[model samples]
Target chain A: MPHATRIAFVGTPNCGKTTIFNTLTGLRQKVGNFPGVTVAPAVGRVTGTNTEAIDLPGIYSFAPKSPDEQLTVGVLSGMEQTIPRPDGIAFIIDGTNIEKGLFLFSYFAELGLPSIVVVTMIDEIKACGSTLDDIELEHILGVPVIPVVGNKGSGIEDVRLKLTDIKEFAVPNKLAEPEADIPARYTSVRNIAANVVASPVRDRRTEFLDKIFLHPIAGPTVFLAVMALFFQSIFTWATPLMDGIDSMFSLAQDGINTVVPDGIARSFLAKGIVAGVGSVLVFLPQILILNVFIVILEDCGYLARAAFLVDRAMGLFGLQGRSFIPLLGSFACAIPGIMSARIIPSEKDRMITMLIAPLMTCSARLPVYALLISAFIAPIYIGGFFSLQAMVLAGLYIAATLVGLLIALLLKKTMFRGAQTPFLIEFPPYRKPSLKNIAVSAWGRSREFLINAGTIILTLSVILWVLAEFPRANIPAEMQPLQAAQTQLEYSFAGRIGHTLQPAFAPIGFDWKMTVGVIGSFAAREVFVAVMGQLYAADVSENDVTLREALGANISLASALAVLAFYVFALQCISTIAVLRRETNSWKWPAFAFVYTFVLAYSASFAAYHITLFLGG
Target chain B: MNINELAVGKNALIERYRSNTVFSERLMELGLTPGTRITLVRRAPFSGPIEIAYGHLRLALRPAEGDGIYILPV
Candidate 1:
């Protein structure tokens, strides 16, 4: 009958706050937006205890620059009516950087919340010949100061036990006020650090690494090379897994056909549900692979350096260096990327980043790109190291980035123009990435993709099947079976809609079938392939020979390129629009995003079709 | 002298902040108040933000904002 005891985890960025939260909560964390805002605050219950921990966004001070920071302050001060006041505070601080940590600690202490300090990165501190005396810190701060290695899970149990007794901890009534004369605040922080930390050595390892990683020229080159390898692996490594999934689904379809009679139910089970969902599900392997890489890069502390390296280039487009992390994250999927935009300190910058994030070639686009490129571009070695197909794949990615940058520039100059805030980012110390964290992250993201498959994609696939299958046209007396099927599709609902829209798409070389594919993909971009497969009566498996041959025989290279160009610009995914609406907290931005992208897709595809035709393709 | 004019590896004492805004207030909250000693850690290439370090904190400030922070050589 008692309300859950709420514990808040607060810290500056890169202080291993989330790592500790994950260690304590394990799989119990629930991600949801704070009341009335799209910034997600993860709340999780401490294992085997009645305490719930709210993981607040990382911030430097109570002064908020963005909606995310404002939410944190709002929740802490009980200003937001929706979030309850916390019963206790579990303040996380980096052990190696005690002064900054102490400053934040002092600031939060002023709120007079019963709090405990968990000094993380104890291993890194020990490696640097520094020692933190938690007992001495406890005496000075009048709260428990527990030294912990968050990533390794060392000393986590102690922190958990301390949380159980947090209600009994005395709240500091006269702690140092951070807003007092700034020098006095610094002096107080220094006095506390001196009392608890002993014989600290400068972190030379970080310096040496930064010298190479932050070097202007070398940094960008290494970044480019890493990206090159990243895209290459997405293509090469995912093929076998994708093919395996394709065969498994096809075999399932075969099993269904033999067991069930040839009826509408059988058709729905095999073609509508199996093939349609399977088509989208096959991209799961590539999405997982990309997420794993991103998680590792983020966990290892390289992503911040990457942001630092590219700040200037991004600055030219009026984007902060902080925008780099979210935009790069969009390459895997825009949902997480848009969620990560909370880290950007400026509101306008975060909005601009989210608007352009979908322009980054997401993994969903990879399936469509690969399909088009393999069907059109020959597999000849371009320069011994690269295949022509690989070049086109890379080119699609580059084109997406260029288009995103240009649009960001235009938005900044017009709709979102304001004073650009200076960039201020913390470069966290490099440490070995925890495999457990990476595994949890990858699994979490993969599960999200599968859930999307089961819900929205499933519903849309069934509807598409009905639209393509029902109201069969009577075969003409002299027509062959193939022509009869085509006629039936032309008369169906989806087919009718496609036919009505075909004239508009005709200049871009799309037939009614391609138009239907485009219409079906409004559910998600990957559905285009499944819809096309159904239209052609070919097995909707990856690399289906019948589908490829049929498509290649009927479609010109110019039309194939037009389709590729269309997807690169089109905001076709309904889920993306939903998230955009939710994140922006209004339909205005999402509507703008959808309309502009649709216009861009149509005009670009039209131009691409004509240009390629003119070039003799 | 302004923060942007400080050479890399040079240390300075923060004197006063020129711009009065929410962002400048945030910079002060991050311990960039007057009399704090700060060093020019590095300048990002292509006239990008300048990295400044003060008492275990490193922050990047664009030239425009950095120009608003007046400092005296330490």
Candidate 2:
């Protein structure tokens, strides 16, 4: 029996660290938080080899700074509570940035760990008209430096072969302690450049893109245009796709109703099975579509550029450029978005950002938006090139941005009075995104949402289906067909609970049946669809209620808008709140987020409803 | 003297930050030594955090925290 030699992988951001990790470990990877910390750790065992690899968060130095950097420090220091430190450390460095990579090399040597230096980006360096002298770097750093491109699996076998046999390495430590005047470290690198490296011959296309992308006004304009395109695509381009999905679900539900017995079982199939779960499943297309952009934007260097472009606006509202990373997170759900506010150095800025994050209108709200767009704002040509639905979506997204920040800024000036955090954004050199990597990330995130949606939505949908199903003791004649197939749920406690809570929602323009769906949606926003589906999926007669009809017949335009508002502004996402709990180490943050978001959702819906009603005249 | 009064190129050690108490302690823990040397890098583009190159590190301290450090121009 042989023990797997575990190697810790480390590197700085955008230096192709993950590329090396993937090359070494392949798909034998799992990512999760280090114990007591929310930062994700990637651990993988090299396939077909007796080696395990742990991918640490990228860091510029070993010293602790921000939470991200601190996380890197913890893992390297073995201070992470959950997992034991790796047996060996693999320091991944970028080949082209040999000069910048050296600092980390010296830093890791101080940890006195048996280590291997995995130099990445060799192809990039080759394209840049330079090559690495692995021997020279080894001589300088007193460590075995394996100069290999981690992306193409080039020189990867050499790394694995070297790691197999552990040899004691000790060179008179060339590492220096933090000096008082390290300015010469910067100067010497410049001198080394003039003598050793040739004139630049690498492609300059990345710089060409960065020019407009990093421009003050121009960069933000490009970012806004990209966002506008994303919204328009989701709203209009997705319409046909969504209709296709809806029709499929409808047909599936119709088939189920016909085959099933005409009793309680059919009611459960209709209300619990179809109406509750199907409604949530219908929005998967829009959610999946939105995820495509998220994965690509993350892979492209554009997201960072987008962060840089919005840094000024963020700073004005007391947020750092880093806040943009998490606020953009609202496209998923705001709880985690708000929870991500922990990265902000200033609590005032963090709190302010947390308060506003839910306003971003996550994809969960898209179903309601799509429903509203179809019913009310359906297509009108805009500039002969755009659909009115597209325009409305663009407007909704823009409003989320503008109105959210306005309220954030206003709150800062009043209740959360505090100055903004200073911006210290790291602008990594942009590169064309990798396709396989982007696909992997999209698969990962969509899978995450699906897993969450599957379990929570399914349970709540079934629960709501039961509640809407009934009491045979006082069964009404019109609902007689619903009884023979009726299970204990028709007489269950949940049904009574829904009826009990029905009156409170009456003023807000929701029927008791809809109120039951709302109770079930508490676990997740998307569950509202499933809960609604499950409630209605039972209407399976020849004139059986359709999911769409179930929704449309039960809900008015104003109520529909109200549901959209509830999702748009409500801070009901459980995963997000869970993340927030971890980030702030306080219930206060999630509580504040929940309360404020609901206040915003409720008030906004109330206002939208009355205005909508007045216009019906 | 307070950091805000220090001239450019002056060195100051951060005593403690004040704006966000949570962040102030956090910064101190990140090696913002009370007697360490800190040189001003540059103020933010808009009136934001005052950037300081503190002891082999560059950090942007909000104005309130920027006021906590004490020093004299080098």
Q: What is the per-residue lDDT of model 1 for residues A1-617, given as tens digits with 9 covering 90 to 100? A: 98888998999877889889887888777775466666768888888788899998887777777777888888899987778878888889989778777777777878888888899999988888878888878888888778998778989998888877666556653447546655577678878788877857767887788788778778778888888889888887888998999889989888998999966788789879888888778888898999999988998888888887788889889898899999999998888888888888777888899999989988878778877787788879867878778888888889989999999999999999898776877767788988777876777776777787788878888888889877877767798645666677777888889889999899888988899889778778888877876776532332345566667777899999999999998988887898898888899998999888888898989999999999999
RMSD of each: 2.7, 6.1
| Tens-digit lDDT string for candidate 2 (A83-140) | 6777777788766565455555556666788877778777776786766666666665
Relative to the true structure, candidate 2 reaches a TM of 0.81
Deviation in angstroms for B67 in model 2?
A: 14
lDDT of each: 0.82, 0.64
Q: List where candidate 1 sits over 4 angstroms from the true fold.
A: A33-35, A164-170, A177-181, A474-487, A538-546
TM-score of 1: 0.94
TM of chain B, each = 0.95, 0.68
Give DockQ: model 1.
0.59
How is the predicted docking of candidate 2 categorized under the CAPRI scheme?
A: incorrect
Q: What is the interface RMSD of candidate 1, in Å?
A: 1.9
lDDT of 2: 0.64
Q: Write the per-residue lDDT of candidate 2 for residues B1-74, one digit (tens) a residue.
A: 77767665567665544454544444443335455467664443354445465422344455555565555555
